[model samples]
Target: MHAKLTTGAMLLAMSTLLLPAAAAPDWQMVAKTFGKSGTETPDGVYRIGLPRTDLKVSLDGVALKPGFALGGWIAFEPMGNQAMVMGDIVLTQDEVNPVMKKLEESGIEITALHNHLLRAEPMTLYMHVFGQGDPVTLATALHAGLALSKTPMENAAKPQASAQQIELDTAAVDQAIGHKGKANGGVYQFSIPRAETITDSGMQVPASMGSAIAINFQRTGAGKAAITGDFVLIASEVNPDEQPRLFFMHFWANDDAVKLGRGLKAALDKMDLKNS
Candidate 1:
């Protein structure tokens, strides 16, 4: 009995020593247009920038506007024993492709490259990025990508897009989702409830996070059915609800799935998916 007890104690001590500590990734250098007015949260890293109106928007002074939007992202998991970085870029529409191509060449991955608004002059593109290894290394990669962008590191010089009521056929969206939805930018938005039995990371997912399905539509054809945007979902075995609001915005129906999967997976692991 004494021998067995001694062996068990030794095993317990060995197990305790093998446990890993909570990770704290070091962000070494960030070379962004605004020089880092962005905020880094437990959830992710976010940068805010105001593009030059003269180039991105066609407008004059008195109408000048300071673009103040947040680009939130973070690193979640470790890879092959290294830290993985993941995040998104929420900037004016035109900045998307440039950022995507640059990041790709620099060994960064872009999962979903799309928009969040409608009729915003110059448009806006939301790019989701993912990577692995050192935090600073990933940040540096982003810096290089942003460096190639035409976006003005400063604020907007004029009011390019107005916040008017966008027209949308709410009835149609509701019909598709089998529920009622509200109007957001002249377009109808619908939310579908996920099956209650589903949960992510052993946590109960709220109706707002991953539970409430969001559907945005645009009128592409004559006056009939409009082409709906990609239906964002938790594709990986990791339920998106595990990180609540920390899921990559994939360009699902738009191709580029294989190219996007690798980086997006890395980003998801790095992000602290808490809030829905």
Candidate 2:
């Protein structure tokens, strides 16, 4: 009788351990873990911006603002019992390995690491991260990884009146790019998604998950601006012939860069499917 009672009690405890959490994750506690509040989109994605305001970076003789270029962010989307998290971490040359090591130790996947700019003073590297697990646990792990670097954990201050607005000729930029852009924290941003589906590791990838072209323009001075963004290319459009077209983009585009790029993409999409 005593043995049976002990066995039943053990089974109950094990079942309790295997069960999922009784309630949803404490988002406020997650924010407390990272020392930053976040906003939730209508689709239930909670995103926290971790701009590298501590870094003083400049490009093409124009100073870069956190909202303009150093805007690091981490987002969490609830996925059943767990959560899927994705983010871009902006780190200096020296802080990359240490922070990456910490993130790896915490079970975060470092998807890609590269630069988003050229000829910028005090170069910075971007570390793209993805993970799926308990929400609070994931946030804690991310906080630990960031703590390995000199990333600031203090509450961000309110933006100044001038810094809150963009000073660029936005209409001219739209006409030249052929894509309308929206203002985001003083930075004008545009996103051009691929017409076809994009897959990674045999799974369909969405545009929100770094599968689209993103362009950002930040006003450096009156009538002057600095631009930076990513070009998401399909597999067939990645040959040597297409390399120079993207790498050496600044030299061209005196006229309509977007139309030229769109035409090129369309051509490539219709390329000889037999050979390509």
Candidate with top lDDT is: 2
Which candidate gets the maximum TM-score versus the true structure?
Answer: 2
lDDT of 1: 0.51
After superposing all C-alphas onto the true structure, candidate 1 shows an RMSD in angstroms of: 13.4
**CA shift at 206, candidate 1, in angstroms?**
13
Instruction: TM-score each candidate.
Output: 0.41, 0.71
For candidate 2, lDDT tens digit of each residue in 1-276?
344558888899999899876665667888998677887755566778888889999887788877777888888776664677888999999999899999899999998888888877799889999888898889989999998877777777776777666788899999999989988778999978889987555444556656679899988676977778888876576775664345433323455888888877886786555654
The per-model lDDT (C-alpha) reads 0.51, 0.80
**TM-score of candidate 2 against the unseen true structure:** 0.71
Give the distance in Å from residue 233's predicted Cα in candidate 2 to where it truly belongs: 2.2
